[model samples]
Target: MSERVLMKGNEALAEAAISAGCKCFFGYPITPQTEISAYLSKRLPKVGGVFLQAESEIAAINMVYGCAGTGTRCMTSSSSPGISLKSEGLSYIAGADLPCVVINVQRGGPGLGGIQPSQADYWQATRALGHGDFHVIVLAPSTVQEMADLVTRAFDLADEYRMPVMLLADGLLGQMMEPVVFKKREENGKSFDKSWAANGHGGKRKHNIINSLYLEATELEEKIHERFKRYDEIKAKHTMAESYMTDDADVIIAAYGSTARLARTAAEKARSLGIKAGVFRPITLYPFPVNELREATKTAKRVLVCEMSMGQMVDDVRLALECKIPVDFFGRTGGIIPKPEEILEKLKGV
Candidate 1:
């Protein structure tokens, strides 16, 4: 077992990515997540990896696109607005089926809202991360330990499915400190096949093309259909959630990332007050863990969703439960973090 080390969340995440065998990082400086780049800037070189701070988020994501086409394990990090700037490149990478990780250490935003934690990007990350008929796998980490742990998972998922994967965190997790135990990079001799990569073939095989553009409408549609099949497979196999004390509860609280931690605390408080409140946390945002959520909340009379945004994930919760049970929402937006007492109050009403 590795010794536990106290580290900031963003730095821990960066180091974990290195331990996951990420060979290159291309990113721009953005608050909350800048430490990821800063940490890697120094550490990646020490590990014989490459790190480059691009001129802009757009350039950074494109650089990721270029590197990923060569079948390298690579990633980028940015805050909300910076992620928006990289959206176009994100679409391009998805269309080409390049595997890479993108980390969003979120902050409040429509545009430069503030430098505090926010879950306002739920829609952007899962539904419309970029303009496309595509989806990236999104993982939400609720703890500093998860912030470190999810990096390797993100990279593995990216490689497994041949698509972009996102580690969706926020300022709270990014800036917080916690003790974490990082596993050594697994050195299994086996590697993912990269026969389709655009890396030089040493004149031994035909050139591999990595382009998203399909001039023919039918061809594009065919590619999209194929991709959707992969999405369906991922959804069926990879959806994940944590159901806490939900076996017998009248009220179920739905939350994710940093907000889920608070919800769990509130659930405990509710239990102390003779109220059966369970917390259901979705770990995979894109797959959304709908079936697991339905099972978790099956005994509930009502459901409450708490978030740092104005009811983005609540809609999903409502849909997941199919609206047979009443779903309520409580939120604090514009970079405000809600207290467990607030969630407890909401639970009391439920």
Candidate 2:
């Protein structure tokens, strides 16, 4: 077993990306997540990796797109507004079918909101991250350990699907310190078959072109349909969630990312108070874990969806349960983190 190390979440994420074979990182510094870039700038070069602090968020994402086109494992990180600035570049990468990793350590939202912890980007990540009929695999990690572990998973999924993957974390997770055991790095050197990559082909093979442009309407439509089919496969296979003491619970709490940690403790408190409450945490925000969510809430009479945003994920939870059980919401927006006692009170009322 690997020895556990005490580290902040952002630094742990940076180290894990290196272990996942990410050779290039292009990003801009932003509050709450700046530690990630600061750590990578020093450590990436030591591991023979490239780390560049692009002048702007737009430049950073485009750099990732260019590196990804050459079949290199690359990534970028930012806070909420920075991610919004990279939206066009993100769409280009997705349209070109390039594999890369993106990290969003969220702070308060809309326009330069405070530098406090927030999950307001949940809608942006799972839905409308970039324009058009494309989706990025979104992973939400509740613990500092999961913050490290999911980087490898994000890169692997990106490579497998030939698309971008986003690790949706919040300021709390990015800044918190915890003990984490990084798994042994599996050396799968040059494992992906990237014949489609635009890297210079030898004289023997035709030059491969990486592009997102389809001038003709029919051609563009056909390409979109093909991408949607791949999306279907991803939805079927990769949805993930964690259910805690939910077998016979009367009330179930649905939450994700850092907020799930609070929900878990609230559930425990409810149990101690003799209320049958459990937590159903979705690990994948994009695929939504519909089936797992349904299973977790099977015996639940009421479902309480909690968030650090104003009722975003609650809609998904209600839709997933098909409104068979009454669904309610409790939230603290603009960087206010709801306490476990608050969630417990909500659970009791439900």
Candidate 3:
């Protein structure tokens, strides 16, 4: 049986991680995401788990790396600036192929920008997160319920692929309150497979290696190619997205995260004014549901990429549409959220 309860998105993420059998959490408190750390600080202890408030974001990510090395489900979270500090550890974890979850409740910034909700880190989260030829499975949640659900799914995907997963949320989704129905705890006595884990090998195994370094160049190239192949498989299987009224629309809106919520509202308003509009929300940011967008653009004349950043996702939309349709961009930066009225106006002009 499932029960529904009103919860903030940050609290929901922490609760869902615990419910998903995560036993370790290390994070630093930062604006718009502080509640996550605070909630875990109190809840993890009761569940026989460990939650540590590290001195800095760098320390927290490294702590997660260490816990994940033991084959335990571990996580760390931060906002934009803090995520930047953890980039080195992120690259290391990706290189080592350690399974872990990293949540980024995005805020505006190239520097220490404002704390208001912004999806300006779309490029950072999807592409340039760390200096390496690596990709992290990125999930975007548009609602508090999806925030919880996606956190659990992120952990599952991380463990399944032995790679890092990122829950790419924004300040609006993090702070909003909504009703969520959580899954019942797994009671089949299941557990993570730890054959590759560095948890002190007994007499059965002679040695264990967790480092990402391969001294031979050919070996490293082979490993990298294998990783990319795995990513391709994930892209085929895990591209999640939602389409609303896109079947017969002239203009379609492509958005994700919290911006999708606003776009949905805007699309509804546009429809009321007798404008044919639809919305496509990418639940997975990295794989990006490009095929879906490509199909939608087959009939649609224009696609307006609505985001909280300055046209980052627009690039993806253009690539997906393959210049078959015109892709326009509407966005606001520096922690400013685009309003539904503004989006409607942009649609009117289209």
Candidate 4:
């Protein structure tokens, strides 16, 4: 067993990537997440890894594209605005079907809104990461331990499916400190067969082409259909969420990432006051665990979707439940995180 270590969320995330065998990291610094690049600057070289502070987010993501094209494990990190700049590269990566990791230590944003913790990127991360008919496996980690464990999982899933995987974390999860233990590389290693890696096959095998361009309309349409089929498989196999005390819950709080932590405590408070409260934490935001939530809330009279944004994920939750039960929302935006008491009050009333 690895010894426990006390660390901040951002630093832990970087170390986890190192453990996951990420040999190259290209990113520009952004608020609440600067520590990630700072930590890696000193750490990557010690492990023979490459860490390049790219000139801009655009440059960084393109660097990721280059590294991933060579079949090397690589990653990039940024906040909302930076992510926007990287979208072109992200779209290209998805279009080309390359495997890589992306981390979003999100801050309040419409356009450089604030430097504090916020979940405003929920829509941007899960809905419109880049322009195209594509999906990136999105995982929200609420704990520092999860910040570590899920990096390996992200890498595995990315390679397994030949796509990008995103760790969508908030600034709170990025800057806070926690005690965490990491799994050995042997325990959390890749399952993807690297036979598809772009490492030179010498003169033995046919050349492997990684591309997304299709000049013919029919060919492009066919490729799009093929990608959709794969997306459906992922949706079927990878939808994951955590249900707490929902068996007989009257009010179910639907939350994810950092906000879910608060919802859990509020649920306990609600329980003390004789309200049958529970929490549903969505771990995978893109391939949302829609069926699990609908089943869990079968007995629920109300489902409160709490977020740090202005009710972005609420739409998804409402859509999943199909308005069978009353779906409500409460949010504290521009980097404000709702307190447990405020959430408890809302839970009680709803």
Candidate 5:
């Protein structure tokens, strides 16, 4: 039997990293996510792991780049502003194809907007997190248990693909506490190949060169094409989503992360009122679950997307449906979380 424990989302994520064999963590403190670093600061040393408090977010992510080059299981965590500062390092890690996990326990943003829960970073996360043609495996976890589970998946997927994976969460999930039956490491199905890791094996092995720069245009173009091939395979095989009461519904709510919880409640309320309603939650933001969403909502008359940001994710929903069915968006920004009553009211209008 798995061990069940009550923990806050941020603290559970810290412990999950330890369980996933992450031995090095480099990050700077930021609001709504400080608990992750603080918990790891105390726990990592006890597990013979390294915990570093860098001078800045920029310095911290660069340290992650250095550590990951050495084939170490390393990670970092921060909020929106700190994540913005780490983008350069993130791009470098992606270009070099180094394996690492970066957690974003998000807060309201545009520029230091507020320390409250928000999903305003969806565009930055899914579209242009870095200044290059690159994509990270973005996972959205709604509850405390999912917060822990996805951390393990993030490390596994990062190592398997040799790229950075992001856990895109918000302050609400990070702050709330719940019971999680922490699964054993054996539950992870992904296989990791470390043959190319730069683990100081001196003269017995060939040197592993980790570099993102290509002086030759032809060489850079060739590498980019190869990366896109891998991305295509991932998109075909790794799409994940969850659907609730979507069958025979007239209207559907498309949501993810913390906002999905209210959507679920609103759907239930809608059902009680004799209106056919359901929910579709995307677990993976990048390499999104396009086919599943299209299948689940194809028969529906309309789709309503609710989010903490001003219609960021709604764009993806519209694209997935190809604008065939009517899509409407209702959202609240700057740290405001919409109540289920409000979402239900909006659904009635939809």
Candidate 6:
């Protein structure tokens, strides 16, 4: 039977990762995301798992790389500044086609930004996170339940594609407590195939190498092309989003993460005032529910892109609709969160 529990988003994410059979965690403590590390530190040992508080975000991600290289399910988490430090390791893991999970409880950014929610890292995540031609599957969870469910899915997708996965949440989601129905544990009896693991093989198979380098430029290009093909398949299969009151609305609000949650409340208030305002929340930030946005724009004449950042995701909304409709932006930054009432006022102006 499924259990109902009240959990903070970060805690839920840790529990979900544990439920998915993740045996290793390596992370540095950062505000808005420290709870995840704390949860794992206490619970992982009891479950015969490992949780290491590395010296730095860079070191933590590298530890994840090492564990994942052994074909063990592993994870790491941090906020914006810390995630920036982890970019190098992330690129390395992507290059090696290693399966691991990285959670970014997003805070304000640029450099040493505040510890409040923000969706400013859209470019950093969707574009190459580090100096490389690689991509990580990025999942944006707006609610506490999704924070849990998506972390589990992130592991499955990471292992399935042999690529890094990121659970992109924000401070509001991290701190908020909500009711969630935890998935019932299932014993599939099928274990992970570790034939490729570097576990001191005793001549069971040929020696394996896990390097990102290809001496031949052509061979490296081919490998990158193949990886992009896999990404294309992932994009097709993993575009997740939610549309509320959008079917016949005159105005649509495009947002994600905490901004989306606030937008929902604003949209409800707008509806009470007889205004046709709706919300479209993108659950997967990387693949981005472009098609859904396109469909919503087909009927709506205007859209308001709200975010904690200045205008990162607004760009995606514009690109999705190709400027077919008028797109306006509302945002706050540097640890300030937008209020739902203010959003409702903005809709009234529209």
Provide TM-scores for the models: 0.98, 0.98, 0.97, 0.97, 0.98, 0.96
Query: lDDT of candidate 5?
Result: 0.92
CA RMSD of each candidate after superposition: 1.0, 1.1, 1.3, 1.3, 1.3, 1.5
RMSD of 6: 1.5
Cα lDDT computed for each candidate against the true fold: 0.93, 0.93, 0.90, 0.91, 0.92, 0.89
Q: For model 2, what is the alpha-carbon lDDT of residue 281?
A: 94
Mind giving the per-residue lDDT tens digits that candidate 4 earns over 241-346? 9999999999999999999999999999899989999999999998888998988898999999999989999989988888789999999999999999999998
lDDT, residue 93, candidate 3? 94
Backbone clashes in model 1, listed as residue pairs: none
Q: Model 5 TM-score?
A: 0.98
Worst 10 residues of 4 by lDDT: 187-196
Candidate 2 backbone collisions, by pair = none
Candidate 2 per-residue lDDT over residues 171-219, each given as its tens digit: 9999999999989876663377789898898887999888999999999
Candidate 4, overall lDDT?
A: 0.91
TM-score of 3: 0.97
Q: List the residue pairs that clash in candidate 4.
A: none
Q: What is the lDDT of candidate 3?
A: 0.90
How do the residues 8-125 of candidate 6 rate in per-residue lDDT, one tens digit apiece?
A: 9999999999998899999989999999999999999999999999999999999998899889999999999998899998998998889999999999988988887887888898
Q: Ten-residue segment with the worst summed lDDT in candidate 3?
A: 185-194
